[model samples]
Structure formats: C-alpha cells, structure tokens
Target: MPDPTATQALGRFVAGSDWRDIPAALRHEAKRSILNHVGCALGTARDPAVQAALRVMRGLGGAPAATVFGQGARLDPMGAAFVNAVASNLLDYDDTHLDTVIHPAAPVAPPLFALAEQRGLPGAAVLHAFLLGGEVACRIGNAVSPGHYARGWHITSTCGAFGAAAGCAGLLGLSAEQVAHAIGIASSEAAGTVENLPNAAKNVSVGNAARHGILAAMFAAEGYDAAPAAIEGPLGWARAAGDAADVAAITEGLGTRWEIGRNTYKPYPAGIVFHAVIDACLELRARLDAPPEAIAAVTVAGDALLLARGDRAVRNARDSRVSIHHSAALGLLRGRAGVADFEQPAVDDPALAGFRAKVTAALDAALPRGAARVTVRLANGREEETTVLTPRGSEARPLTDAELEAKYHENAALGGCADRAAAQIAAIWGLEEAADLGHLTALLA
Candidate 1:
C-alpha cells in the first residue's frame, strides 16, 4: 500500500499557495519568524565555526551561483547554501517548532536565499517558498518526533533535508511529480548525528541538509528518479527512522493549516529545552536584592531528561549553550544568556565559577517537560524557591515584537551589519510588491 501522507504533503507544497491564503495573524507570525532567523544568522556569521567554514568554502570557491550573507563572497548554489546554513545555526539561536523538535529556519533559509540570488527571485516568492519549506520540515518532524531524535538522529539534518527539497522545488518551479521525486531523493540522502551535540558540528548538520536538499531538487528537476513513496512506503523515512509515525498529523488540514506560523522564536542563545530552567533562575535572581556574593548555593530541579540527556558540551563556554546546568547557572549569575554570554572570560569568570560550583542539579520525575523549579540559598542561610512552567520565549509567553526586533538588530550588528542590514531585511520581508532578492543580498553584502 502506498503511503498517503507523503503524497498529500508533496501535492499541497507543489500547488504554490500564497502567504495571503494563510490568516493575517499567521502571516505576521511568519514574518516574525523570518526576522528572528535573519537576525540570528547575522550574529552567527561572526562565530569562529562559521568563519572557519567560510574560509574553507572560499578555498573551494566555484562559479558565482549565490552570495554568502556576511562574507560578501559568492559560491556555487550548493556551496553557498551549505555555508550560509552553517552560519545561521552556528550559535544555535534560530527559531524552533516545539512539537516537531526541529529548527526550521536552519535548513529553510539557506536554500531559499541561495536560489533566490541565483535566479533573481522576488521577495514575495522568497517568502512563499520559505513558509512552504518550514511547513514540510515541521510536518516531517512531527511524523518522526521523539522517536527519530531518541535514536541518535539529528532532526535538523534528517528532517531538514525534506524541508530544503521543498523550498528548492518551489523556487525551481518544479511540478508535483518532480517535487515528490526531489523529496524522495532527499529522504535517501538525509543524515546527521546527535553525537556532535553542542559542538560546532551540530550546526554543520543544518548546512549539510540545506546543501543536500538543493542538490536533490536540482537533480530531480533534470529528470532524476527516486522512490515515489520514500516517506511512507516500506523501508521509507517513517519506517526506517520515525518512532511513532503520525501520518494524520502530516496530512490533516494540509492546505488550510499553517505550521510555519506556529514556530517559536528564542530570546536567548541556548537550547530550547533549557529555557524553562533559565527562566526560573532569572526570576529568582531578579527577586533577590543581594549581590552575587550573597548567594551561597543554587539548586535547580527539573525533568530527568535535562539533567541526564541534555547535551554534555555545555560544561565550557563552547558547549554551554546546550547544557541545562550551564544555562541555569548563567541565568542566575548573569540574568540572561546571549552570543556574548558564551565568551571565554564570561565562561571562566570567577564569579560564574563560584556560582557554578555552588549549583546542584537533579532530575525530578514529577516535573513536566518544560517545568522547572529553582532554589537559591543566600549567605544568610535563607532558601527561596520558584517554579516556572513556561519560558519567556515559549508560545505560552512569547517575546514582544519590539524585543524580537531588538534581538535581530543586536545579532545583525555582531555579524558586521552596522550599516542597515536589519532594516533592509525587515523592509524587504514586509514588501507586498515583488522586489528583487538582490536588495536583501545587498544588505548582507
């Protein structure tokens, strides 16, 4: 029997739906997501990992197929897409869809931007392809959720490949059959490991996915062949990788429901899973008037998953972004975590080390996935406890538009875009009329 879910998803994506077809509120939300992603990419470009990747890409430079955002360098379509994707995710600051547990923008933006530059696509076309790609990535993520991730598969790379294929197919103007084949080819090539967690290599997974997806679409457009039911057939993606396949989730309300709008933006530059604990710690810090010296010890209690299964690289500044313990300690000592929060001095600060050493973390089986309780012990021997159910950047308590813009600007400036990259990206993203993608690329340059 054929896998109907993959067929239905591929069909809806190939139909070329407009962003206007989605609710006005949802469209605004989608715009916010794009802004958040661009902002993070701008900041991420400055990271050593991204710079290293760019240096390597420059060494292997080919025909000028696409423009790399921050470096002002051109590369072949696949090469540009890969490096740009790496830059966007190097800091782990991109927006994430919780249900699917995948960072949608990491894969979607690279291919869309690269193809737009290569083909001179308009802003409206770019936005449309972006939203469609996000939808595909999220649905595929939902189809394999928790299970695929549990099996040591990185969803950003595995599920992201399909998302990249969808985005590229839309940009390339492929037919439904061709798009399906692109997805099929993507499924076969999709791969990323969870073992690289919290390392720069984790970011590379998104880049690889974007590049592979673009290549798959380009090949399919040139009459390449792949399994039609690669997602749902025997030995398909769902069967081979997914834990509990939610076929209905992938197809239900396909055209009317917009999963892209459902994505949540991160206010802090850390893993989404640690947000709840960070919120709890920050709240505790704000409530106490005493200086850091006043605090004797801090204990954070949360779901066992965070303490045990959380990424281990977070013990140092480079790995701390994915470490629940590190984020919790940083939130209590510094009030927030950002790109600057992970610097060597900040990570090695005696004050932070003192707080970090005083902090004890444990898993609470009773706590929910996003719930966290933090207890602070003052020098006076008084303990204050607070429990947080949702983080500030979560859907339950999202960041305001102003906050999102500010974050974008901060990040963009860090990527050496002091001269209007943020404003230019926002202007192009909001344009109703068809504007050349060059305007946006120029801002990056």
Candidate 2:
C-alpha cells in the first residue's frame, strides 16, 4: 500500500513554503527554467499544432484574462495555460528532470504564468509557486519512476497535473487542507499515456495537464474536498498508474532538497536519450575519412530504455525526433541536430533517408540510460566508433546561462519574435523584482 500520509505531507509543505526560505541558487534555477520554457513556447508559436490549439481555445473563449505567449491573443487562465503548455512541449526542447524524465516547466510554468498575468500578481509569487509546483511534480514522478512510465503512462502529463495544481494552490493561497484537496483532485484528473508519444495527440494530453491543474486548484478554493488519502488509497493514482509507489521518494526531501535544482535544459530538440546518440555520431563523423556515401553500416548501442524509446521507423518529423536511425543520420550526415534536422523535409531527404537505412540499434546493458556508443563501417573496411556517457545537456553537463540565452534567441527568431527577444529576456531575468507581470505579458504578446 502507498503511504497514507504522503499526500497531506506534500500539501502541507507547499502550503507553508516561503520565498525567503528558498536558497538563492534554487531561485535562480527557477528563472532559468522559466526562460527556457518561454523560449520553447515562442519557438513553436507558429507551428500548426500551436495554431490549431489557439483556434480551438479562441472558439471556446472565456474572459481574456491571460496572454498567450508569442501571440497577441488573450485567453481565459485555463485556455491560456493549456495553449502555452502545448507550445512549450511541442518541440520536445523544454527542461527535463533526468531522474524522472519529467519536462517540469512545460506543465508547471504555464499555469503560474497564466495566473500571474490574469491576477496582476507579483513575479516573485509566480516563481515561488513554480518552484513549489515543479518540485511536487518531480517528487511525485519519483514515487512512480520507472514503473509509472514503463506502464504506458506519460510521466510529464500524468505527474505534471499534480505540479500544476500545487502551484496554482500556492498562488491561490489555499491552506494546507485545501492544498491537499487540490492534490487529490489532480489525481482524479491526471492522465496521458506513452502510447501517444509520436504525434499531435501527445501534445493534447500535455495541454490537459496544464488546464486541469488550474481547475483542481479552483475547485479546492471553493471548499471542494477529496478523500484524505486520495493519492494513496486502496486504488490510488500510484498503484493505478504504475506497479507501486515509492512513498519515501515523495516524503524524503520535502523542502531541504529541491527537485527543481536537478532540472536540466536540453540543447538538442530531440528526446534526451537520443542526445548521446547524436553526440557519438557527431564524434564519429568528425573522424571519418570516407564520404557519407561510403558508409556501409552504423550501429547505435544503448540501454533497453534507449532502444525502446528511439529504435523506430521514421515516417515523419515527429517520428524522427525519437528515432535512433534519424538521429544518427543527422549527426553523421549533417554534423548537427538542430530543429531543422528533425523536420519533414529533412526526414524525407534522399541522402538522410539512405543513411537512416544504414543505421541500426543494438543492446548495451552495461551502458546507462542517456549514454550511447555508435560505430560506423566504411566501404574501405575501416571503422570509427565513439561513446558518450554524458551528453551535452545532461545534468553532468548542463547548458550554461549564456548558452540558454543564445538558445532563447534562436527560438525567438524562429517564432518571429527576435525583435523583442532581448527585452523579453531582460524581463524574465528581472522577474523576481517586478511587482507585476504586466511588462512581461505585454512583451510576450
């Protein structure tokens, strides 16, 4: 059975957390996370998926209470949160917590941004709430870890709802009891399966997480209640979603060890597991003496998780993002794996398609999750190989603040917001000091 007190314990911790209590380092990390999320959302502002979402939200419009990032349109808090969350995650480039593989900011930050913009709240409050929410999400993700995700649940959408609710609850000033109820409500609403990871359907679930999270908090504010042990009851979220919950993972490091600190931003726009494959392939490409056409075969070696997530047939851009073959081809043929490398045109490129057919995946039990070894055989009978245990964007080799800013600039330019990128960056950096988010929201719009 799950721990009976876990839900309430988490609620109490978030309810009582103070901005002053957070370490400076953690506070700065929160800003970094926010920056990355906004940049990702902006980067895809013009994507068809994001455009479709905006149209649907606009059609089902409510009060124009919040600004949609990179668009001039405003939506209700829930609508805005949902749309913004979709944008942040569409590129698969948001911040990741390596342990749980939860893209924390995509589902957590959108609601906080919506609430802050709608209520004219202070930026400090939003950041604090985001920190609390992301911590809750990652911790809950920890409780379910490999099992929850392996059982077909999308960790980001399923656990992300709880984070969104917790942040909204904190922002709404819900008491400990109310916060617990919010978490309970979130358990009933949270859902997203790994089965839909390949297409637009996956993004819808992510949007639902952000929207429903705010709904959970709103209901809690109205004195709505849920069973005290809703999260760990006989048939609770953990057991229902995964084999069992690691209750201690939830209760162990409440405030002392912030999970947000462990969050890492992505340098490549593909699945984190594929970063190692790209890195290894890039290294091999640099040493190759033969031309691209001379390559006979390429082998990618990684743990079972890597193969399970990445070994696939590439039919479109979305498929290429998680395909082992595509990543190898991009690194070996193009020498880079930027956003353009994963697009449909790139996926359909004659040379890249040919190279992809030459690439194959192999099991490597000794290699850890996010590590890869790639070997290439040339027509001349010569071979080149490389292994990357720690990819560029992993926790051990996180992107620096400047690199993150540069990434933001690149994304902003892609989304057609390059002109205002500098001001947006400045606004986000100075977010904690601002009394209100009016300037940021305006700039975002």
Candidate 3:
C-alpha cells in the first residue's frame, strides 16, 4: 500500500484531536490568532468592499443562522463565513505565516466562528478547531512554497480552503474518513489568482474559500465521498496547484511541533513584505530636522520579491496598501503609517504624492525577504540612511499582549464600534469558560 496521503493525515488530525491533548503554548497561540482575526474582521466589517459583498450575500436570502461580525446582520452559515472572511482580509492586516506568506487566520476563522455559533459550541472547542485549521494551512502552504505563489495563485485562499474545511469538519465531529473527504471536496473548489489582487475581488477570493470550505465539510458530514489521495496523489492538489511539491514538508513531524506558533501579526495595514521599508523610512523620518520638502530623493533596497510585489504607484486606497511608494512617502513625510494613511484624502495628498514621486525601489538579491534599507537625500546635499534588519511585527519582534489589545481597540474604533471592543476582548480572553458563543456573537454583531 502507498504511504498515507496528505488528505488522510489531515483528516486524522482534525477528527482525532483532543483539546486537552494539545500543549498549553499551542492553545495560547491559537487564542492570539483568534483575537487577531476577530479584531481585523471587526475593524473592516464596514468597508465599502465588505458592505458591497454583504449586500449581495444578503440579497440571496439564505437562512439567518449566524452573525456577520460588526455588520449586525444574520445570514446562513456560508454567507456569514463569506462576509466575515472578506472583512478579516479586506484590510490586509490579518495574521500571516512568513514561510508561505499565507494569511492563515482570515480564511479559517470565519468558517470556524460561524459554525461554532450555529452549533452553540463553546469557545474551547472553537479554539481547538482553529488551531487544527491553521496548522493544516501552513503545512500545505509549506509544501507548495514559492512555486505555488509565484505561479499567480494566492496561497491564502487556495490552501486556506483546506484549513477552513478541517476547522469546520472538526466542529461538526466528522470521522477521520469523512474529514478526509472534506479535504478532497475542498481541493476541487480551491482557487484564487494574483491577477485579482488589485481589486475588491481579491477579498472575494478569500470569502469564497471560507464559504466553499464550509460547504465541503457540511457535505462530507452527510456522506459525501471523495478520493482518498486527493491532496498528494498524482494529478492531485499538490501537482495541479504548484510547479513542485515538498511531500516531507506536509507530513514530516506533522503533529509534534506546532506551525501556528510562528504566525505573525502586521502592525501596519500595508503588505507584510513592505513593513521593513516602512520601518526604515520611519526611523529616517524621526532623525530628520528638515521639512517634508527637504528630501530630494529616496532609495529603497530589498529582496527581489519585495520589489516585484510592492513596486507600484498609488492611485487608490487598495493600491496604496500594497505600494512601495506610498509606504516610503507616508513613513518619511508624515512620520507614521496606519489604516488612515492608506485611505482616501491621505492617499490624495499632494505633498505625499511629491514624496511618492521621489522614491525609487530596487531589488537586491542578497537581502533577506523581510529586511530593507532606506536612504534619503536632502536638497542641501545631506544624505542619511537606515537599515531595518528585523521589522517590528515579525517573529523576531512580535507585538506584546498589551500591544495586541491596543491594536484591537484601534481597529474597533476605526470600525466605529470602539464601545464594543472592551466587552469583545473580555469575552475572547474568557472564551473557554463561556457556556456557548451566543454572547460573543451578539457582542460582535
């Protein structure tokens, strides 16, 4: 017999896992990821993109089984999953696994939360499901690596379907065989292209992954069947979705060391890869004695991937969040970068645009993926440079618990629901003790 397949292993983990069996550290990380995901989702639940998507989903008229986060609307579990996933990721501020650049929580948590509420599940169970999902996401993400991402596939939504499916499967108490079927079913539906990254549809891709993954697990729980080798078999997910595969990455030490431990948060709303440039530029800005106009030219050097992904002009809020010029400009000229910095009026500022024009980004093959150097040339012939070897939100320099709580409030305020933040945070921290998710859902809604 061929060795166990990826689908089989993942299914076994999802069904066989016991919350008490997992380590305390892993459980804690799961809570952190959950808090971060909820904060991010609540923050952007009112965005135009999210609102528009919600409008469409609500118009479809499904059963009102779950809350739609800050929107205060109830929809079917699938609709809730779709809308919450979009909101979680619409800001591009969700948790990321550096090895795969996958926003691990956005696609998984929405489905998990929706199902937990639908089933009146306790927070402890929800946490367990979330951990299982995130682990599957990062491991599969590792299996595909740069090959899956470079080929124009958005790994978050692609691999994330598996995570969402596993999470929901765990919640539904599916058996190992049925959970494997869920993964197989999800593989057939997983898809998201980088070509969609520049618009609202990028968020839609993640939303689809969340919604569809839930549907897959729900179907599997009802006796749906799929190929046992759907993930690692020839002509399977690994070969079809990526140029190459690292089978060992998926199965080696699968359950021993937790991959979710490495999940990192973003301090800024922009892309994670651009964070080093933002850090360096902010440091240079702090040292400047001159006005915003003093800078003659700015130069940014970083890894080839950074330049390729971030070297673009800012024309709108969505573009601003991913642009190297916008990050360099806002950091140096304003001495700050935040969600507001990437929004309208701020993005339309003439002074920032002037600085935007002067910034040039180049690729350095030797620099690490998350490291950057920024050099500023002043009009009076003075040039200063700063290099950031470790960005603030990377695993090397993570945000503390207090900082994460502050971030949650900041996001809640941005979402116009700051008054609800304290209660939500309290409930999240005390999740395991709650009787069910109803109180939490009401607070979020």
Give the poorly placed runs of model 1, Cα more than 4 Å off: 1-5, 242-244, 308-315
- How would you order the candidates by TM-score, starting with the best? 2, 3, 1
Task: State each model's C-alpha RMSD to the native.
Answer: 2.2, 1.6, 1.3
lDDT of 3 by residue, 157-267 (tens): 999998899888988899999999998999898899987888877988899999988999989989998998888778888889875567788778777877878999989
Model 3 regions more than 4 Å off = none
lDDT (0-100) at residue 371 of candidate 2? 94
Each candidate: what lDDT?
A: 0.77, 0.92, 0.88
lDDT by residue (1-445, candidate 2, tens digit) is 7544888998999999999999999999999999999999999999999999999998897989999999999999999999999999998889988888899999989998998888889999999999999999999999888988888999999999999999999998899999999999999999998989997889999999999889999999999998887776778888888766788898887999888899999999999899999999888888885678889999999998899899899999889989999999999899999999999999889999999999989999999889999999998888888999999978899999999999999999999999999999999999999999999999999
Each model's TM-score, in the order given? 0.93, 0.98, 0.97
The TM-score, computed over Cα atoms with residue i paired to residue i, of candidate 1 is: 0.93
Clashing pairs in 3: none
125: Cα error in model 2, Å: 0.8
Output the lDDT of residue 165, model 3: 90
Candidate 2 regions exceeding 4 Å error are 1-4
Q: Summing lDDT over every window of 10 consecutive residues in candidate 2, give the lowest-scoring window.
A: 1-10
Model 3, C-alpha of 398: deviation from truth (Å):
0.7
